[model samples]
Structure formats: C-alpha cells, structure tokens
Target: MGPGETGLNYMQQLNQIVYPGIGKTTNDNDCFVKSRSIFFNGTTDFEQSIEEEMHRYQLIWENGYFLKTLKEISHILNGENYDWELDIDSKTKNTRSNYIKDAIITKFSKAPNFQNLLKEAYNKDLRNAITHTQYNLIQGGVVLTNIKGDNHQPFYGITFEKWEEIYSKAWFLLRYIFSGLKDIMELFMFHLRKKQSQVESPFSYQMVKNGSKHMHTILKEGTGGLFINEIALTISYISIFEI
Candidate 1:
C-alpha cells in the first residue's frame, strides 16, 4: 500500500488499541471505573506504544532503532540494564521515568541545563486533586472521598458529578499526550520524508504535521474558560515532547 493508505491503516489500529471507548459505560459507577481503568491501563501501556512507534518510524526514517539506541545509552549511563516496561506505572510520581532520565542524561549530560531542566520538569505537579483524594474500591466501582490530614477528615467528597470532573481531567490528559505525540511524530516523519524519499516510514509525515496543526488550532479556539483546558495544554506539551 501507499504511504497515505498505510498511515490511515496505522491510525485505525491505534484508535482501536489506544482509543477504546473506555469511558462510555451508561451506568455512572461503571463510568468511573472505566475512567480509572484508562489511566491505570494507560500508565502501563502507553510508553511501550510510544517506544514501539518511535522505533518503527525511526527505522523508516533511516535513523536506525531509536528506542533500542536510547535503551542502550540509558543502560550505559546507569551502569545497568534498562527496562522500558519498568517505567509504565500509574503510581510513578516521576513522569519521565528512570529509563527516560538516563537516556536524557546520556545524550545531554554535558549540555548546560538539560539535566537540571529535565529533573525539575520530570517531577512536575501533574498531581491531580483526584489522585490526592482517597477512594474505596467496591465490587461495582470506586467511591472517592477528600480525606484531609493525619486525622483523615473527609473533606469535600466526590460522587458522580465531582468524579466526572476528575475523570474528564484524566481523559483530557491522556488525549492531550496522545495528540501531542502524534504531532511530534508527524513533524519527525515530515523531516524524514524530506531526507529519504521512501514512503515506507511508519512515522506518517502528514499525520504529525496535521496533529501539531490541530493541537495549535484547538488551543487557539480555547475551551470557553474551563480550568481543565490549562491542564490539557500542560499535559499535551509536557508529555509528548519535553516542555
């Protein structure tokens, strides 16, 4: 198949695997559970997807194996074998992960501020209030509560409505990162296409261009003054490419 056809096919597969209608349960409780599942599953799954795509595209771009190279470099820097799978976890406070950290350090360790900047940004306060809130997992779903202090006083609790807000933020974050990565991938592919006239690249030059353009368009359009818009933008920029 041609580049465009292959690109569309890959996009379809991506939508199926990553964009499963995870939060579409009709029941309110099921909705919350599904929402949480996306985050938890995402934390465990998205990195590998990104890495696999990156490597696939890199080979297409004639850049060799980017993920493998990064892994080797990370291993060298850390003086130990590096596992990309280890980085995938929802509870990981450090967003960049040790593997990513070692890779960055390996590449730009001598650079003036890359390490410091990365270190600072890696531990960002992506900590949503929902993550901070306490929750009890029942058979059906989870009940969210705002427990405060050592005394564990229940502050403002979350039922369906409040939980929806949190769920929306989580979903927004996930989409933001996904779209942002698409943008970066598109840009990479665009450059690669120019460098190598081959259309076999999985990077999809046009898709990344379109993705970045769309992200900018959405930001320009604005979200009608929702606080979540800020979070969406922040996560999009931060997660896909280093801010």
Candidate 2:
C-alpha cells in the first residue's frame, strides 16, 4: 500500500475502536484524516524536473539506509543469520567496518545474480560526485569533478539522457528491494501458516543478458500471473488472494 492508503486505513480503524460513537462527527473526523493522509502521499508530480530528481537521488544516496537494507535482505535471502557481518581488514574493522559503499561492493560482488546489477545501479563516480558536492549542471549534461581514471582525467561529463538512465536504474533498484522485502514478509507468514519446517521459494533470480545490458529478473515457477519489469530490475510478489 502507498503511504496515503495505509494512513487512511489506520485512521478508520482507530476511529472504529477509539471513538465507536463518534458518528455524529464522522464528517469532521474523516475530513481531517483524508487531508492529513495527502501529506503522507507526498508530491503529485509524475514527471519531476531534472533538479528535483537529482535532489531526491542525492538524498537517498547520502543517507545510505537503502544500502544497509539491501545487505540485510541479501542475508535473509541467503538463509544466513541477519546479524552476520562481512569480513573486513583490520584497519576498516577498527574504524568504519560498515561503510556503506565498501559493504555494498563486498556483499554484492559475492552475490550470485546481483553482481552486474550492482554495477548497473550503483555508479561509484556519480556517488562520489554527489556526496562530495563535486558536480555541476551543464546545458545538456552534468560534469562530475570527483572522478579520476588511470589517465588522471580531471572531470567526467554525462549527458542528460545518460543521467536519466542511471537515475532510473537506481530508482528501480530501490523499488525492487522494497517490493522484495514485502514479498519476503508475506512468504514468511505463509510458511508459518502452512506449518512447514522449511520452505523453498517458487521464485528464482536470474540475470538475463540483453545485448549490452544485464537484466535481473525474478521468475515464478508457473505462468498466468502478473509480472512487472522495471529496466534492469524485476521483483515478484504472491498476491494475498493467491495465498
């Protein structure tokens, strides 16, 4: 559910329980609930400006919560202890053991079908540029100033089109992880209801090579269900009705 829908449901439940006889003021209560729910729904703009997209992307990247969440999800998928820590060198272990970028690189590099997706979605150069405030907006592109190759090039420029592509990949990756978490939770509940000691997922992850791009696809065991594909990412969920 979206934020607004979830909030509205909560308010309805709260009213039914907390104020069972508030029907005389139902209109007032509902109007307040609906109005406040819109705030949780956030902006209605479907097509945001480039600056706005960059601002949102920078916020997610800088906060780094998604990176940690992704790692935790990977741990769950691998049937590992959730608290398992990635091994680090002594220096890093003593200082910044869970550094976001380093942890992401280490964890996904070893993940079976996720290595290429990481490369596609997580651009170290773009990340450095955004985090360090070393990028500039140009006429039709962005110039990244925090990048240096073996040739020691001072700056790198990415066209607006390229920027959109990269941003889309990152956005889709975020959505995929979110969807996967919800799906996993539902699957866990199903497992408990079925009283199964162990359950094998009907879904499997596959890396499909599409010319120059690698697509990460989550496929179910059967056909005739819904499938949503977003660029290089695909996430599958079992409908509650089906469960």
Best candidate (score: lDDT)? 2
Find the candidate with the highest TM-score and give its number: 2
| 170 Cα displacement, candidate 2 (Å) | 0.8
Per-candidate local distance difference test: 0.36, 0.48
Clashing pairs in model 2, backbone N/Cα/C closer than 3 A: none
- Candidate 1's C-alpha runs over 4 A off are 1-17, 25-156, 197-243
Candidate 1, residue 214: lDDT: 18
**How do the residues 54-158 of candidate 1 rate in per-residue lDDT, one tens digit apiece?**
222222212112223333333434445333232222222353344444544445454335344334323212222223434443322334454343455444333
Model 1 poorest ten-residue lDDT run: 213-222
Question: What would the per-residue lDDT of candidate 2 be over residues 1-243, giving only the tens digit for each residue?
Answer: 122332343344333322332112223524432432332222433112555566545544443335545555455444453432323223234433245456554565446456566566667677667767788665446788776545765668887667767777666666555566567666655644453233333343554343333333333323434232322111222221121
Q: What is the lDDT of residue 32 in candidate 2?
A: 30
What is the C-alpha local distance difference test score of candidate 2?
0.48
